[model samples]
Target: MRPVGCHNEVMTTEIAIIGAGIAGLSAASELAEHRGTGEGILVVEAERDAAIHTSSRSAQQLIPSYGPEPVLELTRWSIARLLEAGNYLAAPLAWPSSFVVAGSPEDVAAMTVPGLRTLEGAELFELCPELRVNPQRFRTAAVDESAVRTDGTALVAWHRERALAAGVEIRTNSRVTGARRAGDLWELTLGAAPPKTVRAATVVNAAGAWADEVGALFGAAPQGLRPLRRTAALVTLAEPMPPEHPMVDDAAEDWYYRPDAAGAMISLGEAEPSEPCDAQPHEGAVAGLIAMIERETSLRITGVVKAWTGLRTERPSDVPVCGWDPVAPGMFWLAGQGGYGFQTSSALARAAAELVLRGEVGDWLSPATRDALAPDGSPDQSATPR
Candidate 1:
């Protein structure tokens, strides 16, 4: 990480990315990989450290069958890329790690996922006996064998390392408070007391929850990004969760639980709308989740050891916003990743890099999928998943 402290002099770069989370860092790494050595790429972070927001807080996973059609495509692509770069991972990222359960076969069929393997009777219980499968609920189970548990910390470090080695500068504690398009370049004002300016040929808005706000600074219209609050907790169960216990998700997408070294990590999986800020967990939400988990599963009584919250910013389509902003020239939208940030990051980053450098995403994605991710694309903003 390069340190460009509070200096009055205006720094210039070929590309400047706002936000140093998984999206920005991964995009930087990808962009740097294809860029000339002399072409400058800068990553600016508002927090003192990168990925301290949603990136570090996620119950890290790479669920290939977990999101919308577009996201699933990206997730599948990312899995291959991550596996190819597995040498950089601290732990093995493999699957049969995520399981989706339903009360009825109809529900399971409705939520059809590619490559989903439906399990039955002893075969299902043998894999995860912790699940309570009765006639009333959790009767059917399916496993996404392609879903992998990702090492979030290691992945972030790998991206940061790759970016730096490729001559990308990452500066922390440099919040972009103002933005203006200066002729052909975008001028971003950072910090106060001694505001420093950064000029770049293009600006990437990967600010996570603050994405829309950052775009407003650059005179771009609101992209309708919603920062939904999600809560998760670590609990002390009467019995320790098996190390191999797979992540169990309700077919309804209401709640999920996975084994953690401490015990088990659980979430009610609510996506309540929230204003962007340092999010805090609600005791009531945690309590509700505990009650639900106990009622639905055979896990014994437990106490919540820790609880936290993170925002999964999303567009109304529940898909990420990639490609150039229609109104703001030289400004690219790389936000609204929602809950599938890490899972689809590699593919999204590659798409972003290609869009930023070559002006097109090529044939990697279907024409409709590419249009769906574009800034001006018509996305169904009617309902954001709860």
Candidate 2:
């Protein structure tokens, strides 16, 4: 590739990925794996480091049975890679953690999750003693012992290291201010000291919450990407919590919590729609979650150790939007992953890279799945709950 811009300043590459989150890093890794010795791949990020937003702020868990069918399939496909990725991390990337989804009988009956078994009486209490609510309040409970606690920070670092080892150049604090198509390549103007520019044959918009904004900067139409605010709090309990405690999720109430390093992390499971920004946890939401935790569990949250929030960008259908945009040539859509991004990053990245480099879906993903996750596919509005 050759540089093409004014001011005698143009950096060229074969592929340019916007956003250094897990999605972008993983895609860069896959692309680097298949690239020629001199084929350049560049990953640009607005933040100073990777996964500073939704990617690192997630309540990381590898629950294959979670999300819509398409998401579930991707999660299932990603588990092996997540497990195998532990080799790249200094410490284990994932730890075995049981998962329990408890709700009323009607709520449990409506949930269709694979390998989920009903737990009652002793089995339920034994599995998750934290649930002190009257058993009658939650008539049904489903348990999945195969779940794992994914280390988000470690996973991002692993992929970043892999991409670096594969000769992928990652430039942080290089925000893309303007983008335009120059012949068969994209000319991206960066907000740097000297106003740098990057020219690439293909551009992958893995900008997470800002996906639509990046797309519009490059003359692509919005794909209905909606960023929702999700709040989570780390509460310090009066007593020590068992490290082996399974993650407990009240499906009917739309909240889930699990043991953290010192205390526990609780989420309100609220997906309130908002514009893309530096998301902050609402005090009311955090308080509400704390109250709910107290009402549902025996553990009393004495104090909040820490609290944070992040955006979970979702399309209208709630399914991830991947693959190339039908109308935007040389531009790929790798956004709207929501909470499932970390768990499904490996599989989604591989499939996306295949689509970008080979113009077809990889064998690892089914043709049906390929079509379902394609950016231009008709929205399956009923597939996943917000």
| Top TM-score model | 2
lDDT of 2: 0.81
> Ten consecutive residues with minimal summed lDDT in candidate 1?
377-386
Instruction: Quote the positional error of residue 76 for candidate 1 in Å.
Output: 0.5
| Tens-digit lDDT string for candidate 1 (1-386) | 44567457699998999999999999999998877542499999999999999998898878878879899899889988888777556655434466555546677766657558888667776776766445457677777766788778888988998899888999999999998878788899998547889999889999999999998897775779999999999888898878767888777665888888778888878899999999998858888888887777778656878889999999998889997876777888899999999999999999998888877787877777787787743242111110
Query: What's the TM-score of every candidate structure?
Result: 0.91, 0.92
Candidate 2 is scored at a TM of: 0.92
Report, for all candidates in order, the number of backbone clashes. 0, 0
lDDT for each residue of candidate 2 in 1-386, tens digit (9 for 90 to 100): 44454353689998899999989998988888766431498999998887898887898888877888788789877887777766765777777887788878678656548558888877787777776456876666987776788878877887787788878899999999998888988899999866899999888999999999998887675788989988888888888778888888886876888888868888888888988888998758788888888887777888888888899998777788887665556778899898889878888988887777777775777766776786743253122111
- Any runs in candidate 1 off by more than 4 Å, and if so which? 1-7, 36-39, 88-96, 133-135, 377-386
How does each model score on lDDT? 0.82, 0.81
Off by over 4 Å in 2: 1-8, 36-39, 87-90, 112-115, 377-386
